[model samples]
Structures are given as structure tokens and as C-alpha cells.
Target: MNYEKYYPIVYKQLYYLVGNNELAEDLTQEVFIKYYNSKEQIEFLGAWLSKVAANIAFNYLRGEKRRIKREENILEEVNNIFSIEDEIFRSEQIKEVRKILVNIPDKQRVCLILKFSGYSYEEIHNATNIPLNNIGQFIARGKQKFVKLYKKEGEINVL
Candidate 1:
């Protein structure tokens, strides 16, 4: 049999299955090599080559799925580790800010902490029952006092 006659047919079949031209060409070559090396005679060469190509393509897809899953797991692990470190750093910064807040007046400290913790001015007013008009003033005064106290504690580059 002139195997050369079937090369293009087998390559096209593999390309359709694998969706990659280079990989299909490589697998087609491998299929022919396997056919040539086999001791058992194949009566239907095309059918045998198709089955072998399908199996090879299936195995390659399975391996690619496993590799992608492993990469995703590694990326997730790295992100989790970084998140933990960021949480710890944020905790330390919050602690330092809390210590400084203690030196400020009660109203100013409350307003500043609520603002830093991501509360809107209206929400802060509702929570603290401070007047809507005074909320801005409180936040401004609180920030000024916090900055002064933070500087006094020998901390440079506030925020």
C-alpha cells in the first residue's frame, strides 16, 4: 500500500480532532510510524489509522486539561498567600491608626475611623447620630488631629 496516498487524509482528520495544525501534523507522523513498526497486519489501513489518531488526540486533550487545572491551582495558591500577607499588613496599619485615634477627641475619632472603614458620610451620620452638616467638619478635624498625632509618633509619610 502506498501510505503516502493516505497522509493528507489522515492529517486532515487529526487536524479536525486536535484543532491545531502543528500538533495534528506531529500526531499524523506518529500514527504512520506506529503503523510501520507494528507486527500485526492491518487489513483496513485507513480505519486503523483513524482509530489510533483519535486515541492519541483524546489522550493529548486529557493531558492538556490536567495541565491547565494544575496551573489554575498554583495561581490560586499564590493569590491566597498574597491575600494573607496583605491582610496581616492591613491589620498592623489599622492597629497603629487605632492607637493614634485614642489621643483624639471622641467625636473626631469616631468619624475618622468610620470614614477609613469605608462608610459614607450619610451612613456615618446615621451611625453616630452626628448632624449631617457636622459630619464633614468632624472628618476634617479628625484627619488633622490624626495626622498630627501620627507625625508625633515619629511615623513619616502618612498615608
Candidate 2:
């Protein structure tokens, strides 16, 4: 594959989706990395690359939205709290979520996280390299597993 020939095209497409040069550059690099790592031949290389670039950019944007919202929520919580005990309780809540996340398989874990992070099915598929048709199933199964584990552990619902 002629990477140099497609670099600008992919970069420009990513920049249009993300509206940031640095993020576009990073996503463009990620697209090429996927290309390099593919074990099978891509029939329509340019189109495939472009599609992947767009998906990655969209996924990044969705994840960013979730992150910003989470930060805002955390800020609000901190501002409203007056006790150190509350802060420690908040930290414990995060740990509980992490424990559930760890108990799931990689695909299920990623699908759940991406969904919770406000990503569309297409975006989750792109980020995890999972198939579009199976995104929902992965998410559903992930949630079921989390709930089962949560109940078994008897952990307080903090998320």
C-alpha cells in the first residue's frame, strides 16, 4: 500500500470529522496502524481506510463527550460534598465499577464501556474492531454479566 498517497486524504477526512488538527493527526496515524496490522488483503484499500478513519474520529468524539460530562459530574459532586468520608466513599465506588469491568471479557468490557461512554453502535464497533451487527449483543451480555457479578458481590450501586 502507498501510505504517502493516502495520508493526506485520510488526515483531511479525520480533521473534518474531529475539527482538530492534533486529533486528526493522531487518528490518521491510528488508521494506518490498523492497515499495517491487517492480516488479510483489503479489496478497496482507499475506501476502507477512509471509512475506518471516519469511524475512529467519530468514536473519539463520542468518548470525549462522555469524558467531559463525567468530569463535570465529578466537579459538581466535589463542590457539593463537605466531608472527607464522602470523598473516600466516592473512591470506593470507582473501585467497585472497575472490579465489575475486570470480570468481563475484553470485547464485552469494551462494548459496555463504549456504550456507557455515549458511543453509537457504529462507533463502538470501530473502536473495538467488533462487527456492527453484534455490538448490541455484546453490550447486552456485558450488562447481564456485570449485574450478575454485582449481585453476587453485594456491592452498593454507585455507578
**TM-scores of all candidate predictions against the true structure:** 0.77, 0.51
Best by TM-score: 1
Tell me the tens digit of each residue's lDDT in model 2 across 30-145.
Answer: 99999999898899999999989988988999999999999999998887775677788889978988987899999999999989999999888778789899999999999999
List the global CA lDDT of all models.
0.90, 0.91
- Cα lDDT tens digits, model 1, 96-150, are 8778889999999899889988999999999999998999999999999988888
> Clashes in model 2: which pairs?
none
Cα deviation in Å at residue 115, candidate 1?
A: 5.1
Which regions of candidate 2 deviate over 4 angstroms? 82-159
